[model samples]
Target: MERNFMTTTKPFVIIGAGIAGVHAAESLRNEGYEGRIVLIDRDTQLPYDRPPLSKEYMLGESSESNIYLRSHESFNTLRIELKLGVEIVSIDAEKQIAITSDGTIIEWEKLLFTTGSRLRQLQVKGSDLEEVHYLKTLSDANNIRSKLDNVQQVVIVGAGFIGAELASSLKKLGKEVTILERMPLPLAHILGEEMGEYFLHLHQSKGVNVITGDSVVQFDGTSQVEKVLTENGRVISCQAVIVGIGVIPNTLLSDEKLDVDRGYVVNEFGETSLPNVYAAGDCAMWPYRGANIHIEHWDHAVNHGKCVAKNMINEKSAPYSAIPYFWSDQYDHRLQYFGHTKDWKSTVLRGNIEDQQFTYFYLNESDIVEAALLVNQPKNALAVRRLVKQQHPVHTDLLSNPDMSLKKVHLRANEDKVSY
Candidate 1:
């Protein structure tokens, strides 16, 4: 399909108002695209950041107001129209128009689908009970917060970052927490089996009933969640059940012909197969770092938004080549992982695991693939990310030395870019 080269005076319609959509809108303005912008969201409130919802917000350390990425005044200042609480029922790509649930039809020259993703529902008996909840939106967070006082025992399904963080928060609040994961080790698929086992020890030591290699087959209750039944017939009674299985991409409104694999498939420039339509964020599946793979990290979403915005307004086309980086905060440890090490052959360990202060480096042959799972050592994470991005090979003995700073290792690379 040919790229839409003709710039129009008509408004650019963005389907969602989450992090990706908000950043895209801001980027468009920054690129001098003064054309009218219409941001449609099914949510009643303004766009907000989701990372805090499972962490500080759940702990009551941050308010909803602070969670918002942008203010309504800023949107007004930019002359961007905010249509909240209105659901787009259908999108006619042929007509270049969108029809909302309330009979509002929005005509557009170019459309950006940043609809984001929805929480995957728990598929088990008694999941319809009132006490079972899934965290995704701001409203879900508020609802979950309201029940915290009464929820003494909480059973969390899935052991991903959200589940892990939520378990920590609830445990801190004096609630008895239990996490159930179908995998043998929590986070095993993402952080490697060794690191996953380390996390298992961390949570178990914190007094959480960590159940692995079991799937919840039923939620035994009358009107509210009473007990969670595993496939092995084991029962876990709890006052509330929080499910964090994962999320599914929201691409129902896009052209059906568009190639969608897990998410809305797009080129490195964020252009879909359909003309005058683009995608970004958790909803987008685009090539990263010249590799034919899609990433769902927050940094990827924000950068994709910026790139899509630039391409939407400028004559010059830029390819998306941002490295994927993600972090998780559980208890006192701040785990930061950089790059994709799915195919790494060996992992080099630094510092003492027993002391709870260390970093792990994943290597593909002699090349540094990824690194820096910092417990208390975060400064090294920056250097490690740089080294991995630069593909600078280091001596295994030098990297293993606890006294050796990453700065010294980069300095040995004969690159003056590494400042003391």
Candidate 2:
């Protein structure tokens, strides 16, 4: 929904002012690109990290200034031109021009569409109530905070990261929280039923109401949220609500010619169908291990931005093959995951899921470490990430033995070799 058209072609232009976009611009400068750079976004404020919005920022654990991507002085010193709060209406690849809602044309030799994603809107009734909210921007967090007063209980529709993190934050603030999820258990589809059950218990232990296999069909109130009606006819009374069903990648400017799958399709280099035109962050479905995936993880976004910036400057840059990783913070637990295993044949359970501190590894038919989730055992992630990246075989005994040296796991590959 957002950027400008320039008559004279600039050196580089980046769409979206989120983490990926800002990193791309900074990478370009770091790579010694002295030409003019333009960064555009719909936000009036400078680019700030989004991960904290649902956790630290919303809980008042972190301040706004602490989350800023970069200082204003740095941007000014780099001679970077920032066009904020502007909507890019359309882009004409034929003429290498982008038209903005502000009736301006900006042309660039290289254009990066790190356009990010828009929060998937709830289609149910009474979703437009003043008390209902979706967190995507700093303003959204602020608005949620502004309504915290007098809000006795809040109904959160989706138990994904955002909903889970926010639920934990709300509980800390002494607010009664109820989570409604259509999935059998929270994050079940992604983490499998076993680990999902662990999370279900994690929330239940925190005193927040966790309801699964049920969903909100509608909200009822007189110009304000009063109660949420579930599909099963159970009504949850609440003063406020937050919906985190999921998100749709912002691909309004993808155009007819560009390949658009679940997201804007891009190759290993992060280049779109159009040359010198790139897409990064959550908007691009990137190639990984003979598969195309749109990983909306914050770490993946930052890496994509950095890789794309390099490839945009020099065509011979290395292809991006980094394994996708993501983490979630809820209460006292920190859940960290490495690689993708959306479809795996076997899941090797390591550590104790009951204790809420463990590592679960996903293996294919051949027993390769395709993906892993470390529950409060992030110390085990580095080895898992390396193992997945190197495509090493997984011996259940090694993973099963908790006393085994995780740091020396990589050494097994070279233990028998002599350097004579």
List TM-scores for all candidates, in order: 0.93, 0.96
In the range 20-113, model 2's lDDT, one tens digit per residue, is 9998999988998888889999789988999999998988889999999988888888777888888888888877888888778888888999
Please list the C-alpha lDDT of all candidates, in the order they appear. Answer: 0.84, 0.87
Error of 2 at 218 (Å): 1.2
Tell me the tens digit of each residue's lDDT in model 1 across 308-386.
9888776238777777777888988787877875667777788989999888888878655554466767878778777
Q: How far is candidate 1 from the true structure (C-alpha RMSD, Å)?
A: 4.2
Whole-model lDDT, candidate 1? 0.84
Estimate the overall C-alpha local distance difference test score of candidate 2: 0.87
